[model samples]
Target: MTESDGDQPTRQRWILIRRSISGPDEITYYLACAPLDATVTDMVHIAGSRWKIEECFQSAKNECGLDQYEVRRYVGCYRHIILLFMLVQAFLAVMAV
Candidate 1:
């Protein structure tokens, strides 16, 4: 679709729906922006990965206190995340032994 200025075309958006097999009334919807040639499977894969990423973040928050602090600067935030992940990695490595 054209922008309000009518000078450029806007990127296309697609909405995908997932329904639970056991509960037909339960539904999940995802809004996505992808290339014109992207397939349904591609979109599904990309959307499915979001859950894993979210789970990782939640795990970090719960297990490593990832969200326990606040930083006002980019460098501070970066350092915090690096340290947090290092702690997580060390913990995982010890658990693997």
Candidate 2:
């Protein structure tokens, strides 16, 4: 970071990958960030698996109301999470029969 960089806000560096071989008209780009010491292969793996992680989180939230919490206390929050997980499991079990 430079002197004028305002406190080095980044802990990782971002890189962009453009599919140049696909030609400009058919081009696609993927942007991702990784630690400064991370290898290209490690970054590639992280970028590749990112979609699957996101998909699982989205499915959990939508089907299980995982993001519907409104509790403030720590214990309340834990209880909500535990019950919600159990409810989701029960739903999956019922559907399997």
Candidate 3:
């Protein structure tokens, strides 16, 4: 992929993985940036983990009000996110009992 940063164009190598067992419509395409020697297994693993990561963020947003904040500063936003994660961790710990 080529992206322009100001005036210079930077090129990045992206790998496309087509995962499907049935038809063309059922195919899942994954575009990822990885090493030239990276295998299909590595790309698949990375793609699979994306769902879990998104789920965790969604859970945080839903249960902890993680997305409800309106902070103007970077440090404030960072602290708010950290606090939300701490709250989530505590909630999980209590539920595990």
For model 2, how does the per-residue alpha-carbon lDDT over 46-77 read when each residue is reduced to its tens digit?
77787686776576677777678666788986
TM-score of each: 0.64, 0.44, 0.58
Model 1 misplaced stretches (Cα beyond 4 Å):
1-11, 21-26, 73-83, 86-97
Q: Candidate 3: how large is its RMSD?
A: 5.2
**Candidate 3, 59-88: lDDT as tens digits:** 777767778867789897787766767578
**Model 3 local distance difference test score:** 0.70
Candidate 3 versus the native: TM-score? 0.58
Give the better candidate number (1 or 2) by lDDT.
Answer: 1
Pick by TM-score: 1 or 2, better one: 1
Clashing pairs in 1: none
lDDT of 1 by residue, 1-97 (tens): 1223275544456798988799999999998876656778999999889888788767777667778867689897787775767578568758979
Q: On a 0 to 100 scale, what is the lDDT of residue 19 in model 3? A: 56
Write out the backbone clash pairs for model 3. Answer: none
Model 3: how far residue 82 lies from native, Å: 4.3
- C-alpha lDDT (0 to 100) for residue 22 of candidate 2: 52
